[model samples]
Target chain A: MYNLIMKDVKLGVPFIFFLFPVLMGALMLIPGWIYFIVLLYFCWITVPNLFNQFKAQNDLMFTSMMPVTKRNMVKARVLVIVGLELLHILIAAIFGVFTMLLYPNLTYLFFPPNIGFWGLGMMMFAIFNIIFIPIFYKTAYKFGWALFFSVMAAMLFAGIAQWVGIQHPVVNDIFYGTGAEQVALQAIILVTGIVIFAAFSIIAYRLAFRRFLRVEV
Target chain B: MLALDVRNVSKSFPNFQLRNVSFQLEQGYIMGFIGANGAGKTTTIKSILNMTRLDSGEVHILGKSMAAHEIELKQEIGYAMGGVDFYTRSKMKTLTDVVKRFYANWDDKTYRNYMRAFKLDENKKIAELSTGMKVKYNLAIALSHGAKLLILDEPTSGLDPVARDELLDIFQGLVADGEISILFSTHITSDLEKCADFITFIANGQIIRSGEKEEFKESYLLLNGAENQLNQVKDRLISYKINSFGFTGLIQADDFDPSCGIKAATPSLEEIMVYFAKKEDQYV
Candidate 1:
């Protein structure tokens, strides 16, 4: 299983994709930017290209030929996806801190990059996983429709969360404020988001594994 | 001990179906799996490996049921599906480095030796290799893993005659120690005639015959005679093609009548397949 994950990273994913998170993370330097688009870049560029590479390289057949179970194959792939998602989030989060330090007084029309904000990002990626992994496994080859639906679903989550942060007075206070009480609430949201991400990802893995078993390749 | 056993295996697609496909290859022998295109050759291979969910029946490898012990059995079974080059953008060494770790008995020295012997450059990307070279690279990997059974599908396709002959010689050498068993599937029967000890013939998703190569050939008789005698033996000829001189046809050895006055000779594997293929067409 470890070997399979390594194969996905070393062969299935191109070197440029590893650098995408850093390049996209630089978007954090933009003072008071719509931070969600930074993460959306991953969905827009990396996910489609990565899946396309796997399809072009005949990854399903290659991995199937190995002495591994279909279940493990799905697990390894999910781990790789989750790993990349986390990388993108972490890199952008670091840049988010630099933005905060560089312009502490600069404040906001949108949901600022805060603990609560990252929690929302996590949930958005969770939604993408829940939708993308299962739909893509339906064929385990063609991913265009899966990518389309997943990116839309993730962006919708991001948009709704951002809208609520702006429109709801209490929600806006918690996201925009820096009080100790607000910080504590933001920490709780982050934890909740992580839990949801883990749960959704596991569900996605199970669904994808089941679909892959039925696939002819 | 049987190296591979497939019993009553069947799979159904929307357009085609495998009907009670059954064959077995004993240890240390090469069995040629000959079939025309879309005859369920790839499907049957997929079923044996449990890559395709079987609608019915079972496959056993090395005396163990594939359903119960697929991963364990796969350790000893090396499979290469022809023409499918995986991870084409990746270098050969990069792919090998990842694959070798999966097997417990993977020998790096053996792998290196095969890479050198096959003239495969480790730095060359898979897409850069020609079709024949791709086959060789597949074989090199299949051999390096200490596999006891090799199931290769059309490994000889698209190769020049010399390259094909070289591959056949390599196959023969692999089984010379009477340890490795090969189930080679191809439409090219001439390669099998040179190396295969047994033959399993399939057509239109059914197993036509499976036995010793000589018995498989000798089972049918090729007949040639004057065009006038065609009427008497028209029913017996499995299929016949008319020519300028007279007509030639394929008939079961048991169905051939010496008193009918037609010259009878044992058919080659190609002749047998051609006749069986013609069986589907309207007799001319």
Candidate 2:
């Protein structure tokens, strides 16, 4: 499984894919653009583009000839997706911190570079994974439909989180209120997001495996 | 013991279906699967490798069921697809290094030797190589892994005649060890004529005939009759093509009599394949 993941990471992707993330991570410097980084991260490590590389060289058929099982192939692929997503998040988070340090007194318009926003990011990715994986696994090569459904899911998660925070004063206070109350809410949301990320990704993995069993290469 | 066994296998798609396809290859022999363009040869190969899901039936490789022992069986079998599709954008040496990690017994020496023998440059990107070179590179990888059962689909399609003969000789040498077995599917009957011990012919997604090469040929006799004489024995001929000059085809040996002005000659593998591929219901 490690080999499979490395094959796609090292050989499947080009050199540019590695360097492009640094540029996206830099977006955190722009106060208003900070919110855009979350969506930009998805663009940087797009699942559809990753699949385009695979389809371009017929990599699935080539790798399927190796001594790996179909189940493990799906698992390794999901692991690669998760690994890339985490890499993007880690880099973006670092830059986000740097921006916070660089502008300690600046007024923020959107969700501040706070723990709660990161928690929201986690939930957004969880939704993306849950939607993208099992649907893409149904027909390993078709990227358009997977992109449509998964992006819709990520958008839905982000829109709802943002809207609910504004519509109700109490719900808004937990996430936006000062000091201890915000910290506690951030911790709770973060914990829940972590749990969902782990649980939803696992469910995605098993479901993708089952769907891929019916896939013909 | 049989190296590969496919029994009662069936698979269906919107436009194609392979029905009750069955054949077996022994421990040490080259079984050439001959078929026309859309004759389900690749599908059968995919089934044996479990690359495609089957609607019904079973494939056993090395005496273990493919369903229960796919990973283990895959380790023993080396499959080269109908067309070679490696990471063409990457250098061969780098890609080979990555692929080497998948198998426990990949031999660097054997791989290097094959690369040298096939005249494949390690530094060249796969896309830079010609189609023939791609096939050779694919074969080098398959053979380098110490695979006991080699399954190649149209491995010789892109090679020149000289290169095709060289690969055929290599397959013959591999089977001489009495341990390694090879099952390759190809439309090039001449390749099998030189090295294949067994031939299985498929037409329209059905197994037309299969057996030892000699026995497969023995079932049909090549018939050559003049255009005028063709009509006399036309009903007896299994399949015939009447060109402007003369007519020739295949007929079951038992159905032909020398006294009927029908000349019978021993058929080559190509002759047998051609007759079967062109067989029509009206002639039957």
Candidate 3:
């Protein structure tokens, strides 16, 4: 299962690189703060799409023929998704740092004047990962249109959250507010997000593993 | 004792259904799973592997219910799918290593021998290998695990003649130990004719017939004669097809008389398959 996850991550490297320029280019038009939305979109889109393609190519058939169980297959896929999320976060953070150094005076568009933007980014990623991983896994198991709809739904929910965060002043302040107090709050939000993501991921893994166990190749 | 027994297995999808399919493969025997495309050969294999849930039936492998002893059962079995998909960017060695980690009984010496036999370079990426080579690699992985039962679904589907021959040889060598049982599914009957100890015919998602190779061959005779001659033997005919030259029909050798100017020739596995597939159509 670890090998399967690693193989998927390796296969996804080129795709991650392909997205880098587009992501960096988008930063020129949108504020750095809004880049979190792009990062979330990247995670939601790539993870499931890769797995769907893997299935279409009949990878599951070969894998199933191995001694591995359906439970292991689901676990491997979930681990790959988490790995991809981490890859995306790492790359995006690097880009964020680069963007800041290159354009130091440029207003951190996504982060409020005083907030810890990195922490907010982590929180947003955690929330999206929590919701999207299970949705995609269930949809992928059902396959075909179900998989497509689930991904679209995940993206739509993430979009709405980003929209609400950017539009509402009170909500914006809670996430983007600056200073020592807000910094501490951002840290709390980041930790809470990690905890919730971990809990949800476990639930998703169980749901997906059980559902997929019943699935016929 | 039977190495594998599938009892009254049934499974259905919206577009297809497999009903009450049952067959047994004895120890040290090769059972050819003969079926045409979409004939549920893969489905049946899936059920045996517990990869799919049977609507109602039980499968026993090595004297244990598949549901109760899946992992234990699978560990003793090796498999090669019809379409062997791999992570394209992964090297052959990487795949071997990954699969090796899962099986405690993995034999690296046997695996390396197969790799050399098939001329597959461990350094090559999976995507770089040809279809036949990929199949060979899949077989190598399957054989390396010290499997007691090798279940192959069209293992020779896309192979060239040489590769197919080499695979047949490997199978023969593997079963030479007389401890490994093979359940191989293939539309190409020639391969099975050479290596299979028994043959199972599946059509329209059901098993029509299964028995020892010699017995299966002995039961049917291929008769070719003029229309008039065929008419005289028509009562014994299981099925027949007419061509402009005359008529050809399948009959029991015992029932076919040589005096009718009809020659009774041994039916090849392909000929038998056509006969049964046609029989299936007639029932529909």
Candidate 4:
């Protein structure tokens, strides 16, 4: 399983993908910017290209030939996706901390890149995974429709979460404020996001495996 | 012991279906899987490997159920399709590094030997290799994993005749130890004629015959006679073609009557396939 994950990283993903997190993370340095887009770049750019690379490379056929089960193949792929999503969020969060330090008194017009925002980013990726993985495995070789639907779902989650963080006073205060209690609430949200991410990814793996079994490849 | 057994396996797609495809390869022999294109050769191979979910029936590899022990059995089974078409941009060395990790018995020394024997340069990307080299590269990896059964699909389709013959020789050498068994699918029956000990012919998603190579050919007789005698044996022929010289057709040996005085000759593998295809065409 570890080897499959590594194979995905080394062969399936291009070198540009590694730089995407860092490149997109730097956008978080723009003080008070819409923070979700930093992570959304993953959905917008990294994912489509990655899955396209898999298709172009005939990855399904190549991987299926190995001494790996279809189930583990899906598991390893989900791990790669989760691993990349985490990297993007973690890097963006680091830059977010720098943004906070650089503009301590800047008036924020959006959800600040606090722990809660990163939590929201994790949630967005969770939704993407739950939708994308299973759908992609339907053909296991085509990704266009899967990418379209998954990115839409992720965008919707991000949009609603950001909207509530802006309009709802309690949610806004928890996300945008810098007080100790607010930070504590943000931490709770972050933990919840982690749980949801893990749970959704697991469910995605199961569903993808079942769908892949029906695929003729 | 049988190295591979595919029994009553079936799968259906919108356009094609494999109907109870059954074949078996004994240990340490090359079994040629011959068919016209779209004859379910690839589908049958995929079913045996469990790459495609079987609609019914089961595949056994080395005396164990394939569905129940896929990963474990796959470790002993090496499957390659045509050539190294995937990861074409990746260098052969990088591809090998990734592939070798999946097998516990992967021998780096053996891999290096095959690479050298095949004249494959590790630094070169897969796309840089020609078709024959691409197939040789795939074989290098398949052979290095200590695989007991090698299932290759159309491994020689694009190769020049000399290269194909070279590949057949390598296949013969692989099975010389009485351990490795190979079941390779190809329409190029001449390659199999040189190396395959057993033959399984598929047409229209069905196994028409499976047996020793000589017996497979010997079961059918190619009869040619004057146009005047055509009606006397028309029903007995599997399919027949007429020309200025007369009529030539394939018929089961049991159906041939020696008293008819028609000339009967042993048909080559290619002739058998052509006659089977003609039979299919005539029915259609």
Candidate 5:
């Protein structure tokens, strides 16, 4: 499995790709940008670019020839996706810290850069994983529809969560209120979101394995 | 134990079907899989490697079920599917590094020796290599890991005579120790003629004939005559073709008719495959 992970690593992506999230993270530095859009940047750029690398090289054929199981291939692929997702998020979080430092009291139209916000990002990614992986694994070749549905789903989560933050008095107050009260609410959402993330990701892995077996590569 | 035993293997596509194809390669010999394009040659090879799912059948490699032991079986089998290159955009070093890690028996000395002998540049991207160079590079990788069985699909199709001969020599060398076995599918009959110990011919997804190479060589007779002589031997001929000047046909050596204006010559593997590929009786 480690070898399988290294296989994707050696098929190095273009340098321009690694820069995508950092550039998106820079958007948060703006005085009053909606942070929800910044979260969308991770899936929008990362998934499409990763799939392109796969299609261009015909990666499944290469991996199938090796002494690895189809199950392990899915495991390694999920790891790579999650690894990149975390990398992009970390870069954005660093920029989020800077944005907060620069404008400590800015009015946030979207959720502020708080622990719960990242927690929400994890849930959106989980939604993307559950939808994208099984559908894409069906053929393991065509990805347009998988990307389409997953993006819509992830964006919907971000959009709905933003609306709740803006309009619901109780939810808005809990998120925007002073440090300790907000921290307590945020901690709850974070734990809940992490739970959803882990659960959905496991479901995606099993679904992907079953669908991938039927793929005729 | 036989190196390979494909029993009653079958697969189906919407428009075609591979029905009950079977053959075996004993522990230390070569089996030449011959067929025309779309003749299920590639499909059979894919099934053996479990690259394609088989609807019904069993493939045993070195006495283990290929379906049940694909991952473990692969460690000892070196497979190269023709025309499909691996990680073509990556450098040779990058691709092989990933491949080498999977085989516990991979020897750096053997890999370097092959690299030097083939004059392969480690940093060169796979896509940049010519067809012959790509085949050589693939062979180097397959041979470096102490693979017990080499399954190559059409490794000789698009090479100059010299390069093809070179590859055949390498295969012959590998099996000389009576430890390694080979199953190479090819449309190029001459390569098989040079090194194959056994032969299996497939047509329209069915195995038409498979046996020892010596038996295969002596079983069929190539008959030659003028165009008008086709009728006299039509019933006896397995397949026949009529050109402007002459008619050529393949018939079992025992079925030949001396009075049909047909003269018999030994049939080559290419002659046999050509006869089998055409669907209708008068296949011209």
Candidate 6:
């Protein structure tokens, strides 16, 4: 199962590389601090697409034929999602740091373009993963449209967050202000995001394992 | 001891339902699961593997309930599907590596031997292999796992005659050990006639008949006679059909009366299957 997850990750690298220029261009439009959020959106959308392909390949049937249990299958897929999420963060963080150094004077609207941004990005990814993975795992082809709509809804929520960040003065000061207080706030959000991601991933795993147990090949 | 015992097993879906399906396959025996297209052959296999949740009934493999000991039961069973789907980009070596990590008893020597016998290129991606080669690959994987019971669903659907014969030979060789049992589902009855020890017929999601191969052969007689002669034997017939040439009916092969001047011929498995499939409509 770990091998299977690695295979998915290897298969996804090409797509991620192909999206580099577009993702870099999108980053130029946003403040360096919030670039991580956009990167999170990219990871959220692309990882599921890769997993959708994996599911459609009928790996479940083949894997189930092995001595492995259905519970192991569900665990492998969830691990793959989490692994890909981390890879996305690592790559985006590298590019973000490069952008920050290249344009030092450019003002960041939120936390600095460093670990703080990656933290927020992880939080956003966690929210999407928790909601979407279990749903897709349950009714893959059947609830495909539902998963699509849910992804779109996540993107919409991200858009709203950006909008609110720009409009509200107090919200803007707390998030975009350049000080230790702002760093502390970002730290809290990052920790909360990790906690949420861990909690939801576990829940999703249990639901998906039980649901797939009943699904006919 | 029986290798598999499915006792009073029934599964229901919205459109189709399998009712009271029961059969037993003993060790060292090959039981052919014969059915038409949508006869629930795949469904029954899935239920036994615990791939699909069964509403009622129990499936026991090697004296253990599948529900209670699924992992242990599956470890001893090998399965191949009618339509095999693999990761197109991965090569056979990669697949072997991945599968080898999971099964403790995977025989690498047998795997290598099968690769050489089948002439399967280890470096070539699975998507590039022909359908026949894909089936061969599936067979190799199923066989190399040291499995005690083999369950195949339509394992010989699209192969040419030569390839089909080769597969049947492989199955025959595997059963020569006299400890392995096989339950294969196929629409092609000729294959069963060649290698099967027992035959089980299913139609309309029901087990119509199941018994030893020779017993099944002796139970039904395929008679060809003139229209009037067929009419004379109609009262004793289980099923009959009228065509432009004459009338043909299935009657008790043993009880067939030659006094009526109607010829009683030994029926092949195919003819027996057609007789049962046709008999259902007449009886219902």
TM of each candidate vs. truth: 0.98, 0.93, 0.84, 0.97, 0.95, 0.90
CAPRI quality level assigned to candidate 5 from its DockQ score: medium
The superposed Cα distance between candidate 1 and the true structure at residue B249, in angstroms, equals: 1.2
TM-score of chain B of each: 0.97, 0.91, 0.90, 0.98, 0.93, 0.92
lDDT of 1 at B267: 92
lDDT of 4 by residue, B1-284 (tens): 99999899988899998999888999999999999988889889888878788889889999999989988888898877785489999999999999999998999999999999999889999889988888788788878988999988999989998888888889899999999999989999999889999999999999999999999999999999999899999988999999999999999999999899999999999999999999999877
TM-score of model 6 relative to the true fold? 0.90
**lDDT (tens digit, per residue) of candidate 6 on B113-193:** 988998999999988987678877877887787788999889889888988898888889888988889999999999999
Runs in model 4 deviating more than 4 A are: none
For all candidates in order, the CA lDDT equals 0.91, 0.82, 0.73, 0.90, 0.85, 0.75
TM-score of model number 2: 0.93
- Judge candidate 5 at residue A112 and give its lDDT: 78
Which of 1 and 3 is the better model by TM-score?
Answer: 1
Ranking by DockQ: 1, 2, 4, 5, 6, 3
Candidate 6 residue-wise lDDT, A1-217, digit = tens: 7755554444423356445535653464455545645555554456556656666676667766766677777787778767656655666666666776787787765455554445556666666666676776675435465457556655665667666776887766756665888778777766776787687778878887777766776
- Give the higher-lDDT candidate: 4 or 5: 4
Residues A35-79 of candidate 4 have per-residue lDDT tens digits of: 888988999899888988998899988998888877788889989
RMSD of 6: 3.1
After superposing candidate 2 on the true structure, give the runs of residues whose Cα lies further than 4 Å from its correct spot: A34-37, A43-45, B226-232, B244-246, B281-284
Clashing pairs in 2: none
Query: What is the alpha-carbon interface RMSD for each candidate?
Result: 0.9, 1.0, 2.5, 0.8, 1.2, 2.5
Instruction: Provide the DockQ value for model 6.
Output: 0.54
DockQ of each: 0.83, 0.81, 0.46, 0.80, 0.75, 0.54
Native contacts matched by each model: 0.81, 0.90, 0.54, 0.79, 0.71, 0.62
- For candidate 3 chain B, the 10 contiguous residues with the lowest summed lDDT are B81-90
- Ten contiguous residues minimizing lDDT sum, candidate 2 chain B: B275-284
